[model samples]
Target: MSAFEVTQPEIHTRPIAQTELWELVMEAADYRCHCTGGLCGSQHSKTGLRCPAVHDQTHRKGKGLVRLVAAPADLGLSDLAAVELPVDQLQAWCPSCYTAARNRAREADANARRIADGPEGTLF
Candidate 1:
């Protein structure tokens, strides 16, 4: 194996551009979530859930929690670049999509590990 034993990536503080963050949030929301669509408090009262985008997914058998990892280090706090606006809003993802993403990541990591281990056959 290579000297780097597939350790988790170090937590680097990367500065996020406000425009980029906004785009990410909007893209995740599709301008349809409670945070963007102006339906925050009421929707949850009726059904104990937030975000219309996710609500719609619930009918289709989805967990509906936002998969957007804008500020994981912030402990469930959305990243806010300015006092007035969140840098990245939450997202809506189906459980299957989330699982697929996770599986893809795992496969990629396994491929990386195999590469690190080098050729299977002995050269000498």
Candidate 2:
């Protein structure tokens, strides 16, 4: 075994414009989670104003580190569409918040569709 190890970055560096957008979003959020909407299944008000999680730091769960992402505020948007959105429409989200929001949105959509279908195998 070698005496030292260098980590190799598997992800490619973002483009300049994308990088700038990400930086602005992160800066605007103060490098913390922007999940004050209460849609992520977390009562952010109880925890404090906005999520206290910061980027590049270990999560409270002692799991992986938190790396915030610049994504569209509308959780229903697809990943492709989210990336095309303008900086003003983007919000900085911690991984857990983003995952929870996306899951809730998807579940809501599925429920709506089920209701619209008017029950299983029923003809009105």
Candidate 3:
């Protein structure tokens, strides 16, 4: 992934120290995309393409690609001060991977809505 510099915390919900958290995440991921087995990552090269894009802490709603969002872990924590999560919970995904993931989620949502709406009927 591209080199990312967190000059300031992006969280605006509450006042919490995110610089350290961001650093920890970056260090844990070795400043690289956490994508594995070529599932989703940079498509720049034929082999071992490491995207140089800013990473995001992506979260998927379900296994069916319902929704994917990027935000600080404290978003769900009632007590923002006690925001702590495992590296796995907050994976570092490159821009490409993140986009792909979001697209998949969008597609899934659209498909679900279409199915729910069912076939359109002609008006007499």
Candidate 4:
């Protein structure tokens, strides 16, 4: 193997909803991304191409797209059972918006941790 070959990290799997939950969430969002009307606007890419992605979970499944997911705290619940979430909380996001949201959350968490840890080589 070449020294430049990079190993991909293992994928973390999450419990996803069955068809019924997927349908409910999609309906609540009117079959479009919740971000569609906000400043994010139109669910279109910077190149002006409309994002063709449907409402989907933030995770992947064995090379397939995951359509919906219950809250992370409820992932251990049965997929066949209905997940009850507040109408305001059950948002449908296109892949681009979803990815941007996840990345922002990740960065926020990292920043919080760094702040809590204090700067390197500094002491109170």
Candidate 5:
């Protein structure tokens, strides 16, 4: 019998001050929308949709949100405030890229599993 193994994704770590954290998120985005990569794609604010806007991260219409895994919980933001907020070092992405990356990751995991299992030998 073959043993089954589970694989976990890698974890990234970083630190930032509360206010500095917002600055980092905004800086990475360059005041542009992650989805359309625009300075004012439909999500633009009256001030032209500033980057690093915490609300943008949670808009959920397939724009501006950048999810981070295993993030630290000491940024001093309320749960709602943290929901859409990106990490200081994390870059924003459109929904398409996010989905594609996830798919590629799944395929890579499958390929790794096949290689680990190896091929059976055939003899006449």
Candidate 6:
């Protein structure tokens, strides 16, 4: 039995309205993850050349099954916000890459805010 023959993957829970957008992004991505070393912290084996993982396929590194998502290329957006974007604004992402990228983006934003606010609790 194939993986698809089993129940739906956790990554595939996008609402029905989003399915068309998802397909558009996936197709543009050639059904492969677009992550380079920048986001996924990948080794570049699945790295610089573009991730080899395909939709509904086993991951190259055996981390888990590969389930790509159509999300905003800009990791700065919250998941809720990203989901609300149109298909043209989205990019194909594997879950691992997405999580790492989102975390990094949020941290960067926080750091920028921290810098702008100056040292915490400082009156000067």
| Candidate maximizing lDDT | 2
lDDT of 3 by residue, 30-102 (tens): 5555544433423536435654343333323222311222323222233343245654456555545655654
Q: How high is each candidate's TM-score?
A: 0.31, 0.75, 0.41, 0.44, 0.32, 0.74
The lDDT values for all models are: 0.41, 0.81, 0.47, 0.48, 0.44, 0.76
Residue pairs clashing, model 6? 44-47
Q: Give the per-residue lDDT of model 4 (tens digit) for 1-124.
A: 7999999984423236355555566676545555432223343454344334444433322445644332322222333432555444455655555556555555667788888989677775
| Models sorted by TM-score, best on top | 2, 6, 4, 3, 5, 1
Error of 5 at 65 (Å): 12
**Superposition TM-score, candidate 6 onto the true structure:** 0.74
Q: In lDDT terms, how accurate is model 3?
A: 0.47
Candidate achieving higher TM-score, 3 or 5? 3
The residue pairs that clash in candidate 1, if any, are none
Displacement of residue 121 (Cα, Å) in model 6 is: 13
lDDT of 6 by residue, 19-105 (tens): 777877887988888777666666556345566667888887787778787778888887788767877888888888788877888
Q: Which consecutive 10 residues in model 3 have the weakest lDDT in total?
A: 61-70
Candidate 1, residue 99: lDDT: 40
lDDT of 4: 0.48
**Between candidates 2 and 3, which one is better according to lDDT?**
2
Candidate 5 similarity to native, TM-score: 0.32
At residue 54, give the lDDT of candidate 4.
41
Cα lDDT over the full model 2: 0.81
Question: Which ten residues in a row are the worst by lDDT in model 4?
Answer: 68-77
